[model samples]
Target chain A: MKLFLYLDRESVVHRLHPVTKLVALPVLFGVAMRLERLETLALLALVVVVVAALGRALDAVAGMASLLLTLLIATTLMWWLFAPQGGLLRDGFQPAALARSAGLGLRLALMVASGIVFLATTRVEDFAHGLRTLGLPYRVAFALTLAFRLVPTFVASGRAVAEAQRARGLDLDHGGLVTRMRRYTPLVVPMFLTSIRRADRLAAALETRGFGSGEKRTDLVEHRFGGRDALAAVLLVGLVAASLWGGELASQPAVQAALGSARAWLEALYAKAASRP
Target chain B: MRQRTRPGVLPGSAESLGVPRAEIARRVAECLGLVGLAGFERREPATLSGGEKQRLAIASVLAMRPSLILLDEPTTDLDPVGKGEVHAILRRLAADGLAVAVIEHETEELLDLDRILHLDAGAVRRDGPPRRLLLEVAELAAAGVEPPVAARASRWLGLAEVVREERFADEVAARGVQVERTGVRPRLATRGEAPVIEVDHLVHRYPLRDQPAVDDVSLAIRPGEFVALLGANGSGKTTLAKHLNGLLPPTSGAVRVAGHDAKKAGTAQLARHVGYVFQDPDHQIFSATVWEEMAFGPRNLGVGEDQLESRILAALEVVGLTEERDRDPFVLTKGQRQRLAVASVLATAPEILVLDEPTTGLDYNDRERMLALLADLHRRGHTVLVITHAMEVVASHCERALVMAGGKLVFDGGIPELFANDEVLARARLRAPTAWRLGRMLGLETLTPEELGAALRGGGGGNGA
Candidate 1:
């Protein structure tokens, strides 16, 4: 209901430059990667909590908690237990090891929490405008925006197809996996086919609207970078720099070895994510 | 002064290829469905379907009378009925010694084709006989395409000779008939007046549009009354309906549900008084189970779990989906999904229900089922305001009608008045119902089939009654 329902209002977060939020994601990403310390990640999580509160996105946050937690746990386990030799398990499962596991979990949680913060705060058009500002080609940017926009659109289509099927008294539930897939195959085909058709329309529409002419396009809600925006940007960059510097400053050779290991694990995580469609 | 032409000269390529202008025109007409348009050759490339573009791609090649035909997703946008016709045409073309290369979504429609090219993400995943590719490959299921309904049903029911295509089409056709029949009227009487909802000078404006989506529209609904709001696209019908439940604040007007001013009311408050259903059922359906979906609105309003159970069951009963209470709404058929949406709203028990374009893409049977549900709501004394395009729906279910033309309420009266005025109907971009059209053709006075049927039988009861 929340996904499809309209919640109309205007707020400062809504009015911010989409590019500001977009750039904020990578900054947070860098911070999460650099800030291997548990305390620093906890502070980042606190900042996210404050932003979610301000944006009135607590409900959305709570709704995504399970998925976020699952991802956090999965990533932490893969990083700590499965990333070659000398992990937390190698040191044995004791209070100190548990505390280290908690640190890994907290860092992953902060990363996910920050992502939800942006998604809940940003509108579809705001993100598109941000991409445009970043000098992404309009064709690709518009396609990305349209793809996001089609989330609700295709959901609507899926509902229609389901309803049409139901009205015909097709029992979608009383079937085996293969049977169910077979039953829904016709449904999925039509929707997939419709999406391709919609893509064609979108391409033509974008072309007609002068999407990729290398001309500046005005927006309905123009996102001007304000003094607060500059301050926020500076603050984000500072945090990432501080995290890396702090991790390096901790002189314990053991800590340095762990940090090196974490970096390798993070690279592997990114490789896996990039491999998916 | 010209020499005689050679006797062996070929006719124009279009004619030589047997690609009659009439066939192309017919295919275009069928694809457009009820949407009117001129010939495709004159239209812009921007106005064609992905399927149409593919067809045009073939048509171009075929125009030269090439011995080969390459097809891809030919009936993508086409409905079930259209898919059969197009498939048949393609088969005929193949029989005529034209080498046809076809790529399609469902194998059912393309089963009889000479060959199949199985590609997954630009790679030739498989190249084989249709029987081997379809029967042996477990990967086809993972690849997200399925055999025709007949094959599926046969496999499921453990029955031989049940081909996938046969079963699938039979299911589709049977469903279509069922939906059409559901449109028939149930036993009901004209509603009593209680003024359940009222609007005075309602207006709304989109952020950028010059004209208000809704403008100075004043109307009222009595308790248990079924009223239909009729208008063309962008006519403000949806905007006006949204105000009934406080989804939108009137720019400069008043809206009251159950005598409470909706402008000052919160959506939660409005939810208790007036349940609003969006045009798209997906807008309201996200819960995993039917029961949970029915409980969603009420739960949002802070109803306790114990009370929610009864409310859920009662609402499910009202929508005639009690049997499917545990099923996933996403898995339900089109008509069932709509009922689930209605049930979700009903669980909140609002005094008034407002629906936007409730029958936009519904088949005849599903439309009937919806009409029956609306009739039931009216009988149960709930205020029902339906925004619709179908004149048949207006004639049958709606007692009162409001017609908007260009952001103005040009007509507000009984349903009879709506069908009687040809000029007003034209201005509203509405066609008269079939009965009304027939009556007009025969120079009769009434505007509905029931009225004409009554008149033909010499019954004197007022058709309005």
Candidate 2:
């Protein structure tokens, strides 16, 4: 029932200030976005792995490993069906294109992994408070955080309604597409009603605590940025700058020769598969 | 984000319009600690119990350290246990010398409060101590407040009903109230030859829980037996009941329902023999009209047109919603919607019915109506299993009681035996019904006020039923 991904862990990354962790997310995403080769992305992936490992967030990363792998394979296959790049294959299904797509997929997966680590490290309260400090409107920040807060509740109620309908003999599994869709009516109506009721209650609960009175609010949580956070922020910005500028280092003559050999090896394997009975 | 409005300057509340962020955080934690919700800081309000939410709401206000706190019907939406929790907190707050006032309808719970202000048509009608105002039965009834059971019973017995439950029991025992004696445990009714539902060594674990939700529970419920599954919240009663209808497959051991392996059989197949009513009626009643709601279950079961009409009509008749067959179900009162939920489940014609907290959030008349409906169903040859915290309802209506604590079946026996086992009752956080206490003090095995009164007045016969 705990569908949220905020893992409770005490680690260096988790202990970092919310703004420190928040800045790391976009910086890490920038590093992943600028790199285009597996060699460079592997180093970036190592950085991610070490960060996640130190943060005790590897379990969550491992949980999504299969999903990331699927995206990698699917993106590579999809790129193979595109027009030939560099004219390396007859139908453009070449290793260069495959490597590009694989790198693109890995970049996306790494971005998502960093986002996951950020979530695992940062509580939703800190995230909202960070936004509030960053000059976002309070209502907008609350709207964003409310989704994270209410999803588990919404899902729990939906599951309850589904179970109730199943008890009443509304079999949704062994039905045709239309029948299944129709059978979901009993579950949907109740979930909708529950959400509305919850909304009404939430409004009253908020109102009673002097919410929407536009009075200045105070919080029990203090997101402090200390010397360690400043150090972390500088290191993250330098890392992003280095990764963006570091892609050219992969195109040096020696690295290009190694890449050519790997591409040749991949082409030979594709030829062998194409010629199979 | 809660606003900071200083009602009074206390340890955490500074006299300022814009409180410091650190101060607010400190005050929030301090208030939560005061209200016994220190570690539940991040829990979703939806996942919290009614009592917990009420406590959280109180903590939100208590952070202000207000000199006087006023609430309107705080326990209205809570169950007996939840109401008890709120009452205890109120008493504690009052005892702490904080001024507290509550607009309450369930007057029995607030007897310990120092004063009562009875309002009639927006005017102060009666202002006195709880002992005086609550005992004026006629005026109390006219004021639309349910006087405590001890007060009503004492009035009927011609004793000065100026009594709390403890005093009533002491007074009745002091009067040398004679009582009829039978076996130590009341005689259980003759049950069916075979149990319709059987759970053997069932252990249920959620994906993330450290301990099993239902740990090694084993019990059987026979046909035509009105059994109460009593437990504190999250004590595995609902988890055990879910196994009966094949909604939850046990992680270990086996559950057999009516001679069929529940784990192997599909839930739809199990629905043919057992129907489940959820705690909230809105979860099940989805149709626009009452008639359609009644027909939904039977239609799902593939009841032919030849029999579907009669089945739906029979169900509506049984739950007494026949006249509102075409009315929109959403427009019905909560009590009627609850009955509609029962009717919808009954439309499937299951022999065994399991209701989860059916009497919660109901007025006295609706609660009685629901109990009468269950009793009627039991009479018509249905095995009824009710998962509830209402000890009084269990004592009066159920033939047997199954008490659970910490996911273990602590006690399974007759009502009086369950109450007499103080350890089990304490483990389950259950209080015995007032009638049971009064009757026990009077040396009888009665479960209802009528029965207890009759036995106490010496009705010229022995009482055991």
Candidate 3:
């Protein structure tokens, strides 16, 4: 089974230092958090798309395309329902609520896209190497790798469990909320226990292989962070700088007016596309 | 299992490590080169073949530069090619003077070892050279270890020694045993009946793979037939089997299972007629008690409350697990857990059973029990399709064999025809089990040890008589 979104493609983004790749994640998350403007979130989404394209990981984006769209539309509509009207839907959809809800929806989608890009660009071994370099303890770094490997094991088991149950005539599709949840109950226990057992097996295998003997281990093939990695790192850092700057820029009146108009224009475009058929 | 591998050659890059980058690369290259994976440093571990992954693990341990290395069942899940690669690498390591101890159930690997330690239930039953220990077939068989084919056949032939295949022909010829190029008994299934499962030009392409997992291949299995699906890993046996139960809808062509159009039908609807048992029982067993696990399938199929108890009981009884009905499934032995998986599927009362490597990782005793259970099911008129790498199982249990390679079904015939076709066997990465080879040497078709023994005693003018 494919372990993660990590595609084994040779590309500029894929060749970046695992640590350098991971640096984008926290930075992206931070930007998404302070982001009030839908346009800024859109910028972050574009950045993710560019990175994904460079990594040859557009497939990852396309693979989860429906889910991402669903999250965007669902989160937007759902948030609009609960948006603080300062009054309710009695007044037409408030621009503030519309902006806030759309930003939230776009923000959620951007965060997931950012994650897809990071995982697609970063290899698990490189992730471990980067974590350990960042002073993540040997055992902790090893544990994280085990966790990464276990994801597929758990997924495979979960699927097998479902298929096995399905073979026994267990159908979860044709049910109400409670009925579906109840139908799913049989899957959870086995999946959980089976995953735990698999985790234990993975850990035991690592232990037997002398995972942490307190001696510094050397990699057989050392990956050199080439000039391209440095340039990619610089670009990622510049993106962070721009996001930080945007946080301060949003306080100005002119920038606020500009961001607000951009948000409204984006929402109108979305509404136009969505309302068609 | 993949945790056995490291980042490759080492755990860290050049800047973080004390060793010079050049030195580390040299070491990595040396180790990987030793294992025949010199050019695979850049390959992602996930994408490597099973045997390649095993080699990477061995190479990681090899890179550690330890004098002593140990492995437990390192080749159990690999194809014959993978197994051969691992054995070759380890033999080279042993020749280079490393103390390599391997805990393996497959007796074939022991032929290359300098010494053999025969263990029975955690106790050392015999510690001797392979030449001596391998010949003790009776004791080895009793200990639940499959004796090397040479040893078992030689013993059956009443030969005193010679436990290697190289000398098997000469040793047998000295006793006037004639070799037969073609000694296969055809056991093809009758073809008048409609197929319980049929696949026509089925193709399945995975999301990221360039090639289809199951290519445009066609086959049919008649009801009440026991069939073996044979292939190396990634050869589409599982993918093709998945189509039979509607777990995977074909990318092209059509699949018909028990008169239902698998492409159009829901998996649950098809599940009523076909039961699938996975390779690992741990993947599916979740109930606290054996009874609950057995009840799961029947309850899903909507067996009436009154008949549910009887259904569960009958399934449990069929697997000989009635005594453990109230026991926690987790506490059961691996073999028992596997049996419970079989019973769980049995509870649904599907007429067609598709088991994926049911006897893998099982000891001889458990294997025999599982085979007996399967025989019983076959006797009760259930169609069985087993996807397996075990040629011994194919030899004795299955009436017909389907061999797949590069996503294509290259051979479909009786088991004897399968063993005889070298081209299909090569493509499928299968080796004829020892019984078949021994049978060929003696000019008598044999599927099991008993069959060989009876044929030998009756045909050979033995002085022991």
lDDT of each structure? Answer: 0.62, 0.78, 0.79
Compute the interface RMSD for each candidate structure. 20.1, 6.1, 6.6
Q: Rank the candidates by lDDT, best first.
A: 3, 2, 1
For all candidates listed, what's the TM-score of chain B alone? 0.60, 0.86, 0.93
Candidate 1 lDDT at A60 equals 66
| Candidate 3 structure quality by residue, lDDT tens digits, B1-465 | 012233432333322334554565666778888989877876756567778888888887676577999999999888776777788888889999999999888787677688888777778888988867788877777777777766766666677663466666566677775343434455584879999898999999987688999999899899999999989988999989988888888999999999999978878888789999988887777778999888888777778889998888899999999999999999999999999999999988999999999998998889889999999999999999999888888888999998899999999888878877888888888888877777766555677766665565555523321
Q: Is candidate 2 or candidate 3 better by lDDT?
A: 3
On TM-score, who's better, 2 or 3? 2
Ranked by TM-score, the better of candidates 1 and 3 is 3
True contacts kept of each: 0.00, 0.57, 0.46
Off by over 4 Å in 1: A1-277, B1-194, B443-448, B457-465
RMSD in Å for all candidates: 21.3, 6.1, 6.0
Give each model a TM-score. Answer: 0.44, 0.88, 0.85
Q: Model 2: per-residue lDDT, tens digit, A4-39? A: 677766788877877778767887887787888877
Candidate 1 on B69-127: residue-level lDDT in tens?
A: 65545654442333455667667667877787776655655546556778888999887
What clash count goes with each model?
A: 21, 3, 6
Winning model by TM-score = 2
